[model samples]
Target: MAVDNATVVYFSEQVVILISCGLSFLGSLLIICTYILWPDLRSTPRKLLVFLSVSDFLSASSYAYGVWMVFKSDSVDCVVQGAISTFANTCSFFWTVAIAIYLYIFLVKSNRRLADSWVLYFHVVSWGIPLGITIAAVALGRIGYDASEVSVGWCWVRIQATDHVLWILLTGKIWEFLAYLILPILYILIKKHIHRAHAALSEYRPILARNPQSQSPSSMADLKLTFIPIIFISLRIWSTIRFLLMLVNSPVRQNPVLVTLHGIGNTFQGAANCIMFVLFTQPIRSRLMTLLCFCCHPSRDTAGDGHAPSQRGQGAETPFLAEDTP
Candidate 1:
């Protein structure tokens, strides 16, 4: 017998979600490990990245677990998975916005101490609000297995809830939408500020003479920041579209291709972040490469040790994470 389209779509969505969540989990884990292994890489920005990865790690893992328990829709584990995913995913969105705000304050406003002063606030808002929302959702009995009609292949808000829309907004969608709006505007403002700073520097050649390399790293950092919002928006737009369709009770919301795309997009954020913040980042990648090379060529240990003294002195003075300026 030929397989029906519904069965084919369901199987495809499950496979895509599993693979995407697996990649995201591994990528987030790598970032967490990198942070733990290298104290030198623990700058303010990198510290924020580690926190973001932690949330992504939880979000992706919970999502994978939800997919695994998709058949057990009414089980307690299903509700637990839904709750955890909601909290962690919301935290991820908040942390992303927090990073943007940190960049704006540090680079655009030139606030050198904002990271130290504002990190507590960032944590309280990013983690605390999600915790509160998740608790309320659980208390109200909103989280459970959403069937294929509502979700791709995971647990989330119950379709039968009288106030499902309200819970959805409180749990995840509201923050996701806010991030979509806030990130682009903040990044654009930061870019314009950098341009103005560069223009001013060009007019005042003496400043450049004093510190010729002052703006180079900032420019490079700006280039990296430009990709962040783009990656986030691209990966998230599919799910957002699905959500809007569901609100209208449109048949297109259940289209297999769209469902697969939504599942992939929802679970692939951590992997995308890993590619952007780890693989493509020069400072972290260089350090990772050097460590790998040293591990592979242990026979050159003596030669490497001989230069350790000078390397240590230079490393102490070098600013590996000084890309925060404009």
Candidate 2:
């Protein structure tokens, strides 16, 4: 029994997608639960991260829906999958941008907290924009958005019409290009600002050390915090590059190994965020552990009460989210 390469690749892609969906679903769910149960994680400064987590949660769920649709294929299901996945994925991208902007303003530009009203602006831009784009694109697809084709495995933006460039531009390439441009610039600026701040703190370490209560927060911690966006952009860029390569060289898509790797990187996008938030963040991990212990011992009277830092430079109170710019 000689299985064709196409058959092997198709099966491998499905398996990889299923694994990615499971990892993303559980990982995002744990993050959501950790945030919901821990009141300390719900401060105003952390609202962006909370919003981002919600977006990732939806994205993961959408991926699962896409997988289900593969089993029960229909024209309506294809359209619905495209609409839902596009909207959710777009929100995730915008949320990441919002976080980057928030970090830049709070960490590099000024010490002041973002006004509470700013959250309204973030939600409007992040959610509202995606809603509009998804509606327009899906509506147009119904009327023959040529590049908006659905695969049996999943529904995503793919070029079906080599002659009609408009659909390809609107589908995903433009947004991906914007991401490629914005993320690198932000990353460089953030790293530079952090390094400069660390040097300034070192110069005054002796003075700060004399007052144990007022010691400067660890720059290394801040550096580690910046790695979240770095890793995110890196993973996304890798997937995007492979996608572009596949578009140009369709034969490469038949390679099961490359296809599997691409599925693992792209489909598990939410899982990456979960690992960063739960594993890399000390405050969240501590809170999560306490919650688990309480669940295990229902009679334990000690419900761990703690405060997370609302802003940078708060001694001994590191952020449970992404605020690491002391």
Best-fitting candidate, scored by lDDT: 1
Once model 2 is optimally superposed onto the true structure by TM-score, how far is the C-alpha of residue 109 displaced, in angstroms? 1.2
**Candidate 1 per-residue C-alpha lDDT over 1-326 given as tens digits, one digit per residue, 9 for 90 to 100:** 11121112366578779999999999999888877865555667667878999999998998887666564345788888888989899999999999888878866777758645898999999999999999988888888856644456677887667788788788888898999999999988877776678655332233334456744535444566577888899888888887788778777877778888878888898898787777765545666676667799977665444433432332222212222111
TM-score of decoy 2: 0.77
Model 2 accuracy (lDDT, Cα): 0.58
In candidate 1, position 282 carries an lDDT of 52
lDDT of 2 by residue, 1-326 (tens): 11121213265567667778788778877767765665545554455666776776776666666655452323666667667767777787777777766656655675435534466788998899888877877665531211212222455543343432455445555665776677667766766775577556343343345446534444334444566657776666645655565556555544556656655655676788777767665556665676677789867636643333332133222233332311
Taking all chains together, the TM-score of candidate 1 against the true structure is 0.84
Instruction: Give TM-scores for every candidate, taking all chains together and pairing residue i with residue i.
Output: 0.84, 0.77
Clashing pairs in 2: none
Ten contiguous residues minimizing lDDT sum, candidate 2: 143-152
lDDT of each: 0.73, 0.58
